[model samples]
Structures are given as structure tokens and as C-alpha cells.
Target: MTVRETAATSSSNYLTRAGRGRGGQGQAFRNCNVLFHILFTLKGVREVASGQLRVLQISEKGLRASSRRKDIPDQFYMCIGDRQIHIGCVIVSRKRGLLDIRFLNELPTPFVGAVAALEDPFALLEEIRPAVFGLDGFVN
Candidate 1:
């Protein structure tokens, strides 16, 4: 089997063994389920997109870490210069390895320019400090 298929099967086996299947119980199982979704979501972000909006490695790490909190919002914002810029909203599904991100508006000029110049967008996100504003949590 292909590497991707093997990885997927292994992940599925792990989830089943961890009691995260259809009829799983206990808080630990639930937490494992959430962590699985977060990890796969970041993986999708890293592997799916291209061009100016491709997710950076550091940004993926940040997203993965922040996604551990249940209170984090579905959207992300970047703090650039004197403005808090709305970048996009992310919707992650528990049963799928893909995430849907909808941009709130046009990306900032500087960010676009940087990407156009072939600069690492993830580094730019890091330098600017991205923030997530959710109903119950604010993470930077």
C-alpha cells in the first residue's frame, strides 16, 4: 500500500484501540478524539493549499497547539502594524482530514506583496503574531 494509505490505516487503528470509535466512553477517549481532529486539520492545511495562501510549517504548529483548546474560535486574525487584520475562518471536521478556510476579505497589501516576493508567509504570520478570537477564548 502507499505511504499515505498506510499512515491513514495506522491512525484509524490507533483511534479504535484508544476507544475513540462509535461507542467510546471516558474523558480520555474524548480528548484523544479532539486531538486527532486537530492534528489532521493541521495536516490538511499543510498539504492542501498552494500559492500565496499555503500554510507555513510554524503556522501549522501554532494552529495545532491552539486547536487543543475547545474555546478557540473558528477564525484567525493577524496582528500587523497598528491593525488587527481578519485573515480567514477555518472549519474542521472530525471525520475528515480536510479543512475549509474562508477568507473574510482581501488579504493585506503587505502580506500579499510579501508572498508575491516569494517570502515565507508562515514567518510573516509569526512576525505579526496571529490571534484567534472565539466566543470563549482568545489565543495569540
Candidate 2:
């Protein structure tokens, strides 16, 4: 039998798949299990669509989020309740207000940990600081 090395581990350090990322090809990942204050702006666009959103799911590869902001282009920079953490993303699918996006790079473990450690990720839902357009270009 081939041994598979999974990411999430138990207290004994044995490999396990529970609570780990699921980004397999053609896998239909469940969405909207968690909610945290998230911010993002349309990539390549001069902030035409920048607003607060709720992170439905987060993984090493990307995110499943819900946003009311309209006209979201194909790409954007997502901020996990912070202005400094700009994660470049590309839209994979959109329906209603749900946005399935893939990150340009694998998310660092520490960053994801920080998100999971938040006392209340959705405490402040009214603000997205530095509240201005930062990403460059436009989606044509």
C-alpha cells in the first residue's frame, strides 16, 4: 500500500486529513462553514469593486467567500481583515454572492493560523481600513 503524507496531524504527530485543506482536482468542497470579516478589491482594477466580505472557507490554495459587492472582476487582492495582507486571487466561479477564488500562491501556515486564532473574526464588520484602492490596473 502507498503511504500518503497528509498535512493536518493529530497530537501525536501522526498524519491525518481532518480539518486539513481539500483542493483536489474536481473536488466539490463544501462552502460557507465559517465567517470572518474579509476585505478585497478587484485586481488590476482601480478599486472599482472593493468591499467587505465574509470568508466562507479558507484553505492553502484559495477561499470561498460571500460578497455583496457587484461587478467583481476575474482577479483581486484579498485582505484577511487587514490591509497589509494582500493575497492575490483569481475568481474560479461566482454565483449569487458566493465567490470561489484561488490564491496566486499557497497561503503561509502562520497566516492561516492567525486567521483561525482570531477572538472574533467577524467582530468588526463595518470597516475595511486604509479604505482606499491599492491594487493597480483594470480588468478589461
TM for every model, in the order presented, reads 0.27, 0.53
> Whose TM-score is greatest here?
2
Q: What lDDT tens digits, residue by residue, belong to model 1 across residues 47-124?
A: 421112233211211221223234333434433322333233343222233332323333333333333343433443
Error of 1 at 81 (Å): 7.0
Q: 10-122 in candidate 2: lDDT tens per residue? A: 32221112113334365333333444434444544455546656776766676778876676655556654345446666666678778777766666544444444545556
Give the Å shift of residue 43 in candidate 1.
Answer: 25
Task: State the displacement of the C-alpha of residue 112, model 2, in Å, after optimal TM-score superposition.
Answer: 2.0
In order, what lDDT does every prediction score? 0.30, 0.52
Question: What are the C-alpha RMSDs, in order, of all predicted structures?
Answer: 16.1, 12.9
| Model 1 bad stretches (over 4 Å) | 1-72, 78-96, 108-110, 119-122, 126-140
Clashing residue pair totals per candidate (backbone < 3 A): 0, 3
